[model samples]
Target: MWIVFDLCVEGADGCEGLAIDSTLDHPDAMWVYSQGNWTHSTFATGDPFVYVQLQEYGNVVEEIDSDSLVVRFGFVKNMPTVINSDLEISFGLPENDVVSLKIYDIQGRVIRQILKNKTLNAGYHSFSWSLFDASGEHVPSGIYFIELKALRSGQREVKKLLVVR
Candidate 1:
């Protein structure tokens, strides 16, 4: 599996930076960071836009087995949800699996727990974020993250959300 991450100013000219990683480099920090949680200091000053791409390549043997599980996860239509609004999130699974989804701030703190170890059916599934934290309070405009994980398959994906008031 290869993942690419891009962070830059929205409606701006160039990308601030880019990071690419592969499964072969396991146990090491990839794209985002090497150790601690990602903070605002690591990003550009303006409203940041985040984009991620996941690709999987397999040999003949793996390819045959890969048919059993195809993972297609991301925002609906590859767009971020604006702040103070309901954000639609979607993903596809080839088989039923236990999954968890959460929202985290730039400091890697869990602000909201959308789903936790819940079973989902095979097919396209989606949920909406109300732009509120676990406490039901409105979230401040800033950068936050949406993370989804397939517990059984150990598959994890992350996307950034820029909350503007």
Candidate 2:
């Protein structure tokens, strides 16, 4: 799974100061810091595209099988109505794309961003949520929604979740 993150590099002619500062070699933090320059006709023609290839750099810690589920809008909707603790969400991706999974309140406010701008393989994938808000505090018992969206593929899925004490 490779994701292409681009910087327009558009600015003044003397933009030699523009550079991509990468501190960590990890795939998740491939490009930590980046400086932009001018990429238009004034500075240059055609923006330079960077296709970053995602690589696995650790031992297999844990794995779960989720082959039975199907991809609906780049995700599945199978979830528990009421839960005592964590929630498991299962979904499938047809192809490699930038995926983001977020928990939203009933009023359509983002509660927690579980996954953001992560490169996921094309297959069944699962994520466990601790039902906590952005501040790491446990959410109140109520209704929430899981929004699975693929930015590149333009796919989105919204499913409801009920948390109870």
N/CA/C clash count, model 2: 4
Candidate 1, TM-score vs. the true structure?
A: 0.55
lDDT of the structure predicted as candidate 2? 0.67
Candidate 2 per-residue lDDT, tens place, 34-117, comes to 333223222222333333222322234446666554554545654777887988888888777899999999888998999999
lDDT of 1 at 120: 91
Off by over 4 Å in 1: 1-76
Q: Tell me the whole-model lDDT of each prediction, alpha carbons only.
A: 0.67, 0.67
